[model samples]
Target: MFDVKTIGIIHTPYQQKFGVPRQPNLVPLGTGELHLIAPFNHPDCVRGLEQFSHLWLLFMFNHTAHQGWQNMVRPPRLGGNEKMGIFATRSTFRPNPIGLSAVELHDIVIQDNCTILKLGSVDLVDKTPIIDIKPYLPYSDSYPLAKASYASEKPAIMLTILFSELADQQLLLKPQLKDLIQQVIAQDPRPAYKKKSLSTQEFGITLQNANIRFKVEDDIATILSVE
Candidate 1:
């Protein structure tokens, strides 16, 4: 048997799984702080981390706990296309319940023995337990000719933003709303195989409890209504 321990807790904006991006890179602007807990705070443990542009975060799915793991999981990209083994997918439910993500490292200021991991491109849920960290060596991580068996090719995509004509007189230019909308749409919510018909259809994501619905027309996505 192998023994394991949590290095620290990762802090994220999401308290629940309802709206978080499926992966970290998908939320390129999300902010997070890795609250380095005691014991793992030993400076030697995090030595030389500042030299890397990005680091691989190894964390645990403390919220998505599973008992007697399943062998297959349906990836959202496939829109329930086919079943693949747990090992082949980054599903939260697996025999080990571990996760890995390459996140941009914004800063690494050390306080006493603790290292404050300031980061960008984070999409983890609040208080997620971290197991380990490793530098992402570009020489080995990037492969220009690599093949993606599931979703390799990038497709032509477009989006729009139209605010409600009835928007609050004093809230028409709220920065948070724009930030939220940009964050939500950049994720490309539509299923991979689905046709790009959002040009005239309405769709939305929950923002600050309001359903920020909109319709994409031509190249402009109009925020038809907010409720």
Candidate 2:
């Protein structure tokens, strides 16, 4: 068996899994910082990394690793009705619990003696343990014509987001996060089962320190509060 060591910890606006985008770059405003640990926190470790536009993050699903995995699992993209092989879907409940994401590299900062990577379009939750980081070589990594059976295209924007007067007032305190909050809510972060049922349920997602509360009615989602 091979042993893996955590090289860094990622800090992001997503404090929990409920609101994180299923795929990276889905929410362009989403940002994060990867702080390298002890031995690997030196500037020499990330030298010449600034030339690349993106990086691939190999991280662990620490939150759900304890639950273990199964051979067959339901994917949220399929509306949670069909069963697919665990390997075929990007489900967090994996045998190894490792996940890969391609994130846009914004900047690399060396402060005090630690190395930190500023990232954009990140889909990871806060305090995610990073196993490894590799430069994303576009020449070989991207395939514009690649075929993804079920997820061939980007998921459509499911809801129209509108902020209430109170929510608007609260947002002024953190104006920079407005676009990020809007894009996240527009994805309709509801469970597959909830999408199928007709009920007035208010949902809340924690981004940073604020709790964004909203309700979805028909194709529109109204932001009730941001506290």
Candidate 3:
């Protein structure tokens, strides 16, 4: 049997999974904490970890259950309509239910009270269990001359942030807010391919005790209100 053990816990701002962004790096300043567990907490484990600016995480889809396996899946990118081979897309529902995310390691502070790794650009839900961590080695990891397939294609639209004066001040101080919103919206959080005869319109997405309503006009997104 192939046994897997969780070595750490990830504390993120995302409490729900309904509208999570596709990639972590897209998050502007999305912040979180990486709490390492004991045994892995031995000082030796942390050695040479500080040299890298980012790390790759392999984790489990604890919230989801396996229902055998499907050779094909309906992806949100296709407006939840078209079916594609599961290997062609990165849907959370899978045979193995494994999840991988790349996150920025801002700092690893070993406090007497607790040892933690402050992080950025996390697209994980709160209290996600992390299976393992590996530093990003540019030599083996980077591919300057790589094809991104369908992913390389940009979305037909873009996300814009228009914050109220109160939110503006808050964003300036904690820029992570802007990044967080972008990460959430950029994935075209709307229902995949819902046809409404409109390319530009206004909508809202909830986050951290705030309701963000935005409008898309002139191909530019305008933050309409925050209530």
Local distance difference test, each candidate: 0.70, 0.91, 0.71
Candidate maximizing TM-score = 2
**Candidate 3 lDDT, 1-227, residue by residue in tens:** 78999898988766666555666765555577988889887767878899999899888887764555589987765667778899988877788878888788899888664668888878777778888999988899888887965566545444454555655655565565566666666555655554333677777666654577766654455655544
TM-score for all predictions? 0.74, 0.97, 0.77
lDDT of 1: 0.70
lDDT of 1 at 203: 66
Tell me the lDDT of model 3 at 11.
82
Clashing pairs in 1: 160-221, 161-221, 162-223, 199-216
lDDT of 2 at 172: 84
Question: What CA RMSD would candidate 1 show?
Answer: 4.4
Task: Kindly indicate the candidate among 1 and 3 with the higher lDDT.
Answer: 3
Q: After superposition, how far is residue 137 of candidate 1 from its true place, in Å?
A: 1.1
> Comparing 1 and 2 by lDDT, which wins?
2
List, residue by residue over 1-227, the lDDT tens digit for candidate 2. 89899999999999999989999888988889999998999889999999999999999999899999999998988999999999999999999999999999999999898899999888899999999999999899999999898899899998899999999998887887878889998988898888887766689999877888998888688999988
| Total backbone collisions, model 2 | 0
Predicted structure with the largest lDDT when compared to the true one: 2
Model with the higher lDDT, candidate 2 or 3:
2
Q: Write the per-residue lDDT of candidate 1 for residues 186-223, one digit (tens) a residue.
A: 55555544334544565665554566666655656566
Backbone clashes in model 2, listed as residue pairs: none
